[model samples]
Target: METTFKDFYDTLIENLECYAGEYESFIDYGPKLFKVLCDLLNSDVDKSLRLVISAAIGYYVTPVDVIPEQTYGPYGYIDDIYLSSHVLKMVADVHGYGFIAKISSPDIEEIIIECEVKSLEILSDEEIESILAYIGL
Candidate 1:
């Protein structure tokens, strides 16, 4: 059988719980971001945004990412979290935080904003660019 998004989400969450290290707090939002992507996929958003959201989800589930949790543990989720917030920011730009808040949590916007800032603090622009390029996102 083909692996569904739920299967990926469950596996990612399990890995995150075991590997979340110094960035544990930031990594904690990994599940929430995955949930937001799932919610967006089910929402009435346009096709392009859904594609980008899907890419972000793919990046999160892949073990061979820029910072693989398989290698770096919880620290590996930094890039995944960053990409999620980045994609969510793009959606919010189009539909507004209120729109996302309806599908996700009331504090999701805040969480995304914080994750973006914190991720930047850890990874440089070059590193973030490489991560994006790694997945062709």
Candidate 2:
């Protein structure tokens, strides 16, 4: 059976809540980042942005990522969160944070900002680039 986004979201949240890792704060935005990605994918965005959004969402669900949740548990979500933030930042840069905030929840802009900052602390620029390459972004 195909795994729905909601199902993945539930598992992501459960893992994060039960996690006891050093990157807890950075990974906390996994749900929020996922929510925003789902919202964007459902929205009437242009094709290029939609592709990027879809890639990020695909990365979230796929077990063969930079850090697989199957292996690292919730901590594996760190790369997923960073990729989501990176995609969100791209959308924000093009349409502005207000536009994303409008499409998603109003408070999401702040959460996106926090996720970006926290993700950087855990993953380096080279690591982020490697993740992007891994996902073919």
Whole-model Cα lDDT per candidate?
0.85, 0.82
Which model scores highest in TM-score? 1
After the best TM-score superposition of candidate 2, give how far the Cα of residue 73 lies from its true spot, in angstroms. Answer: 1.8
lDDT, candidate 1, 32-78, per-residue tens: 89888988999987787988888988887786988887787777788
TM-score of each: 0.87, 0.85
Best by lDDT: 1
Q: Please identify model 2 stretches exceeding 4 Å from their true place.
A: 1-6
Model 1 misplaced stretches (Cα beyond 4 Å):
1-6, 18-20
lDDT: worst 10-residue window of model 1: 12-21
lDDT of 2: 0.82
lDDT of 2 by residue, 1-137 (tens): 99756577787777688766787766877987888888887776666898889899999989888888889787678888888988998998788888788777788878888887887888878878889998787
